[model samples]
Target: MKLVRPLPAYLVQRYHGWKATTFAENKSWYRRLAEDGQHPRAMVISCCDSRVHVTSIFGADQGEFFIHRNIANLVPPYRPDGDYHGTSAAVEYAVTSLKVAHLVVLGHSGCGGVRGCFDMCSGHAPELEEETSFIGRWMELLRPGYERTAGCEGTEQRLRALEQQAVIISLENLLTFPFVRAAVEEESLTLHGLWNDIGSGGLEQYDPESDDFLPI
Candidate 1:
């Protein structure tokens, strides 16, 4: 017998109904999106964690934000790659092509990527030495955070400190991009740092006021 996905009939019907409206009957909504160039108001850099989908947190519509996701949500210092700079390419496009007015780095609580980078720094993950590719190269952006917060009192405290520091690193990297920095200098762009606490269902903004995260 072929395997079948177990489903409640009502849920199946509702799901199909919504899918039809979102994709079939409502296909024009998406068609128009592609037809018209995307003009999102913000460019958000976030982690690839499934738990921290920023769109769900913000109730964003189809084209409200341009998104870039990477391990621990890093933004590398800009350099001439001689070719493709995947994350940096997204940043350039968002600032130059899309011209989004806001650039945001969305960090999250309990980020596994940050912990892995920290562990790699500790020689806990010896396999890191063998992997001389994308992950190894990318994790460079978070090393400063791992080093800075390693001495924090507890595991949770260390993680929070590292997470916050990672956000700042990304902000600095964003400034290294010529287009992004130009936009900021010209007063056409502003940047924000967000910490999403998944367990608490709370969003925190970096309160420059007290230099802490505060509920948004």
Candidate 2:
């Protein structure tokens, strides 16, 4: 109904217009998984931005990746009473419940949420208070990047640094989760950092090999 109906404008406009290849398969898949259980290959922590889709970016099939999205793709330091734990809850479910081995933190360039941290540009999204608070707090995790790149470049450079910082923040917060931490310590799970530049269709990865973000 949600997919067929036009009541929700976003769905009608964005999804209903497209030819859904997975709709039929997704219905059966959902029923089958609900009856039994789900076993996804990986878990992705990504931004709420529609352009940075994890599925199409990685060519993920049905039940391939469990995704959690939030503004700027933040993972706050572990706190049970964080008021808004929607992001963390999804992480908990992905790690503890699903036991996904590969966790990917996905960031992207030209992120409004990341730019909103400093209000370098106008972010008129009043409904995103949690993200407003979160971006403010989480950006601190990128202080080294800000410092390293400060007073040295244009606005675009700073924004790129913030995108990179988001990846670092997500990885750090993942370590704060006991389930995720234990899995990593036992060598059962591995964490990855990624940045997607939507404009150029460029995918940059955190190459530990080069100790820098590199084109992939």
Candidate 3:
């Protein structure tokens, strides 16, 4: 705790400004949320990238969506081995405890994590090849996605394909969880995969029947 410092002056100033305006205006809503507890309709698994604003994108209110963020929005296959599984824990809580109706795996263009996975899988990033590299280990989850796009011709095309594949991979992995599978089977939960074009602010949703992402 000694290593921790006070909040940056700029952030503190911004917080005070928000407290004077946004928080004051929404004080009643905030109090109601505190009293009633959260009951978000959907759970969004998105990347830790700062540019990808989940709430802003969806125009969501404070408790409209339960969100979990990670390196690449990746969800590992279910393995209840009693290890530290942060993502799995969140998934379990969202599904079993919160009973969210929709679970979305959202990917975006120009994702650094996806790019790192591509470089690592292509043998271009030697530093990531190190056994001790945390990012490398995490990116391993996307190796299958890289393989799926290996046949893609151009780098741009391949990268885009891999990015979309990341969402698809996560959606597929979500089903490996017994709870997730059961919920889906009972028609209590639904899974969705989405890819966003950061520059254009366009969205594409995965279509199971066509096996492609259709513009949304």
The residue pairs that clash in candidate 1, if any, are: none
lDDT of each: 0.85, 0.78, 0.96
Best by lDDT: 3
lDDT of 1 at 203: 86
**Cα distance off (Å), candidate 1, residue 101:** 0.8
lDDT of 2 by residue, 57-105 (tens): 8898767899888888878778888487887899889888898989999
**Candidate 2 off by > 4 Å:** 1-31, 120-148
Q: How many residue pairs clash in each candidate?
A: 0, 0, 0
Say which prediction, candidate 1 or candidate 2, comes out ahead on lDDT.
1
Which regions of candidate 3 deviate over 4 angstroms?
none
Candidate 1 lDDT by residue in tens digits, 1-216: 467777889999999998877778768888999999788999999999999888888899889989999888888888986877888989888888888899999999898888877777778876654556566556767888778876799877888888888888888888988888889999999989999888999888887768777888
For candidate 3, the lDDT comes to 0.96
> Largest TM-score belongs to which candidate?
3
* Model 2 clashing residue pairs (backbone): none
Give TM per candidate: 0.86, 0.77, 0.98
Candidate 1: segments with Cα more than 4 A from true spot: 1-19, 131-133
Candidate 2 has a TM-score of 0.77
Question: How large an RMSD does model 1 have?
Answer: 4.4
